[model samples]
Target chain A: MPTREINGQSIEFDNEGFMTDRTAWNRDIAAVLAKEEGIETLTDRHFDVIDFMRKEVEEKGTAPSIRRLNKLNVVPTKELYQLFPGGPAKKAAKIAGLKKPEGCI
Target chain B: MKKLLILGAGTAGTIMVNKLAPVLDQSEWQITIVDHHETHYYQPGFLFIPFGIYTKKDVIKPKRDFFPTGVEVIFSGIDIIEPEKNQVKLTDGKVLSYDYLVIATGSQIKPEETEGLVGDGWRKNIFDFYTIDGACALAHFLKYWEGGRMVLNVVEMPIKCPVAPLEFEYLAEWWLTEQGLRDKVEIEFVTPLPGAFTKPKASQLFGDFLDKKNIKLTPEFSTGRVDAANNKIISWDEQDIAYDLLVTVPTNMGDDAIARSGLGDELNFIPTDKETLQSKAHENIFVIGDATDLPSSKAGSVAHFQADILYENLLSAMEGRPLRAQFDGHANCYIESGFGKGILIDFNYDTEPLPGKFPLPGIGPFSLLEETKMNHYGKMMFRWMYWNLLLKGAELPIESQMMMAGKRV
Candidate 1:
């Protein structure tokens, strides 16, 4: 339950630094997160994935995986990697205030 | 008679059919199990196929071998499921309606989902061990062939038997060392997860093992496409890892029938209530094994654990009682670490794998989160138990819910 002054608002994150209070996230915080993820400027394409992820999480109670995003033609997976860089699914999920994708050990 | 239809005569479905058939008053309940395939492959044994440790005899068996008497077995392709009508139509035009349905058509590898995966080099240079054919093919390819860059890539998260890929790598490391070809071969494990495993403690341990074994680790690699012609797998971000022989666990998805039924997530995994084991969309329908989109390890142990709760809950549902049996998402797996040693991990949805003795607490015949020869024997001996005791629905000594009795936090 670590709180950070993100976007001039105190926001909480888990030990992994994924946002805890998902409701505390906003467009401004997304920019900060995007910058932290090495995307200095948030573009429309970035918002597209972030928004789609947020909506999917809202509806399905979980973040849609990269495969699902590609399967549904939400975004071309290569573009998703280009947009988020490094780990697109995990990084985009972090920016979108969603938990790291759930998987069994 | 009220009809109970069980889809997929795999481990979970078969277990349910056996457990319920004798208990549910045969006169009142007409139990029927449907599956397209006649053969029931011991899926865990597939991991040994590539190393010449096991062959067709160990993995393959007639599906009917496990079915209890009086349960109708239909061997035919599943058409679309009419959930609204409470019926499933076979490809042969017969429709079977049921009061309660259990969906357990397990997950399969979708190599076609990735670009260049199924093309020219497939079963040649690129291979998968998740299936009997793939394992056998890899076994053939490995025979008399000198190794080079051997890359094992898990294309995505939530693949069936999450530990198998690591085990494959470890076994390769051991087997190659045995053959004295270890010096010439370079081993690399590429995965979507940040490390060797989902849990932090176990991941660290497995990561250390990989390091000690001289197998390289490539973490958070979201596989985009297989560059078979070039002998490399390119991640979505275009991070490419070149391999002479690529053993890829291409996207594991639920049955295509789930997609046709429109009762599944994008990956065709049924949206199931994790605790109740009931379909989120249809109350009369329950999902088990790799078919459910529960955040549990897609392994036999999970299905075995789920079978107990599903049994109690299905009976409760039949009697119009609230589903009191909650599935704790218990998954117990023995990771075959090779060199005749393996690791045992027991965990649930809430708890991560911890260092402890299992089942018997301090006096456990099996240790948790540590590599031991006893654990290896436990893994090997499971094959017999799977066929004899488990699929027969005999009560196992282990509890379905994960316990903190012996675990060190």
Candidate 2:
């Protein structure tokens, strides 16, 4: 783990920059992190997904996989990719202040 | 007499029965195994079926032949497990109680989980090598078919023998080249993983192999449904991949019995202690092989290694002793790379597959992570060893825990 000054406060994260302390996250931090991850504008839909992912971690102790989200009909995977380009799972997990998803790889 | 009940007569359960049969006091303990099927298929050989190397005869064997004598066998499907009562009810309405239970009910391909996977094109253009019928049907189709755009899509991850899809592409490319159809056919591997595999090093190695062989790689394509009418697979992200022949590994799930008993996750895999092999929900219940939701691969080699730890822990539990043995998720696999050469990989939870010799530290007949003809021969001879020695609990020279002494860092 490594510590970096994020949102004017030092926070712990893995080498990949996913936050280790999920509780330290807020919308201000997410907006800055999202922009760094190439998410130009944070819309209400993006907040919906980010909030849902945080809720999933609060309940399941892990971020929801793209398949899981699609199966639960939380959000269509197409919209997810459109909302967060590149890899949505990795991006959303970072913004939601959740640990990287394990179990698969 | 206290009863020891086992579910599934597959490799994991059979090996446990053999390992314990000679050790348990026959006068004090009565051993019984239950399974729904009479025939046990050598699942690894299923991959060779599509390439015309192996047939149905090579893989099919009577499950009764594998179990040792003095063990009571029940041929019936499991309905549910009443874990609290320490009893399992068979589909035939018979109740069998046990002092201890071992669940080895492995996973299977659930093609129906994906939309249109089992539709009009199934067994004709859409085939999966995970099942006997699918392999044989694909074999028949490949024998006379001309080359066309071929796409192999893996619906999700954590499927049994994670390397099978890679090996399939290797063999298919070689077979196509040998048949002078390499130029006519276009091949693509579509996977949800970021790369060729879960592990970083092996993924790089395998991804390079695919590139050198000219097979296209499509990564991060989360499959949503199959358009059988148009012979295209649609991703949940709205990506469409067209293929003349679609070979897919659909969503794999644990036995439905796990679901009926409410002892499993969403995929019906029992939540297990990764090291102790004990069910998280019960003390007396042990889980082995693909039935467990462990992060380790679902392969015969994984089950074989788990058996070593499980056997020790199981005996300890029987004697009211604390479980001491810990499984490090050791998995050894031989990858057939076609053209009579193969590669081997030995890894555990913390280690990725590295390049070096195997079994023997200084000298090994089988080289790891590098393709060699000797490795291919090792794979060919594994069948005989599997049937005669492995199933009978013979102690192989290879350690249950992976050894890194010979591997290069």
Candidate 3:
């Protein structure tokens, strides 16, 4: 399995750069992943989404989508794009340390 | 011996080799086609998969089964195309050079291009009918899904089979009613296009049918993201179209290899002469089907129509004769309106879909832009026509150019 070094710790990833293990994720790791995803800074809004996805993954065994995020009323769909420039779900899933969701391609 | 290389063994590529096999001097010219997939899918049948109208076996067949005996078929992914060098590199690290190349690799649905579309909700509440996996998943999802708001959304345009969403909507309505769930499910058609279709006259006609079916038309809604948690599609303008089950037609773009080769437009479609179907970038390279940035519907019928003209033009180019045949962007579509009824539309780059009889002008057979049981039969019968005639490059009764004889122009 391919892996990337974040904060001097080796983190495992798949060929597409998605995290292999969900438990290995942390706020510091998300900051590094966010930068890799082209985000210069991790704002509170970004954390809000990350936190929601983490909580959902814990409860439902998957990350929360924009549709699901919309239900929570934390952010709008337009803002999700702003948060993740391209492929928010894949990026969010990566940053959240979840396996890349199926049927994304 | 000179080699003619073709990319993609789908509808256009298969037809190209089948048509050119006998036309070209076999001793002098060798034809080869490359595609990563082993199986050739009858894509039109994908529309019926969710409804159990057609099974996987009904649509898929080995690519080798359709290739003419003399033509070579390569099952490998293309790594890069060096058009300037007249060569292509495969993922296996093999390089093949060709005197002439035809790019028939078509468009693909990219759900990830849209934010939140491919999230946890994908293949769960949100499904696409464009792919075998997506269609099969949707089929399973629809089986036990108690009805609610069902939205069939086309995220962006220039998609293959523009009317497929409408067809799906019609079928969904028919299926729901048959299952006694019609009253429980509210179906809506969401699109980025301002009308029901690109053509004005046809949009008007189809708009009436959608209205009659009581399917809400949310046109001109540029989709921003899919809020799967809330089961809604959000527009750029913050307009929310909620759905319990969303069947989305995500953004359709040309093959990524086109972009990797640096031979594609903004959307990865190869820039080509609309009339000649020849690539504007390279004189030796020709493009056909959805891969070319031609102003024609990216349907199997359009590919079949273009194949006829492309065949003539390729031969002329090789012979050093001035290319005489011109493609008129001719396209024919059979719109399945469900409940054993369908509609047909025939048009070209210049003509809008009109009401009339097809094939023989004034002779009764298939009606254009009119819903009828005969049109439904025509639609169902096309699966046989595709496998036996269209892919084999056997010429049909229809002309390569658009005929205005029977049309109410």
- Ranking of all predicted structures according to TM-score, beginning with the best and ending with the worst: 1, 2, 3
Query: lDDT tens digits, residues A31-61, model 3?
Result: 8888888998999988888888888788866
lDDT of 2 at B141: 95
Query: What's the true lDDT of residue B244 in model 3?
Result: 86
**TM-score per candidate:** 0.97, 0.96, 0.80
* Residue B403 alpha-carbon offset, candidate 3, angstroms: 0.4
lDDT of 3: 0.88
TM-score of 1: 0.97
Interface RMSD (Å) of candidate 1: 1.6
lDDT of 2 by residue, A1-105 (tens): 798787688888899989999999999889988999988889999998899999988986767767668767877777888898778888899888888878463
lDDT of 2 at A57: 87
Better of 1 and 2 by lDDT: 2
Candidate 3 residues lying further than 4 Å off, grouped into runs, are A1-105
Q: What stretches of model 1 exceed 4 Å from their correct place?
A: none
DockQ-based class of model 2? medium
lDDT per residue for candidate 1 within B1-409, as digits (tens), equals 9999999989999898989998988889999999999999999999999899999798888988899888899998899999999999998888999999999999999999888999999998989998888999999998876979999999877789988999999999999999889999999999988899888999999999999999999898888888878898887877899999999999888998889989888889998999999999998999999999898889999999999999999999999999999999899999999999999999989888999997798988889999999999999999999999999999989898998998998
Q: Model 2 over residues B1-409: C-alpha lDDT tens digits?
A: 9999999989899899999899999999999999999998899999999999999999988998998889999999999999989999999999999999999999999999888999999988999999999999999999998989999999987799999999999999999999899999999999989999888988998999999999999989878899999999998767899999999999999999999999987788898999999999999999999999898999999999999999999999999999999999899999998899998999998999999998797698899999999999999999998998998889998999999899999
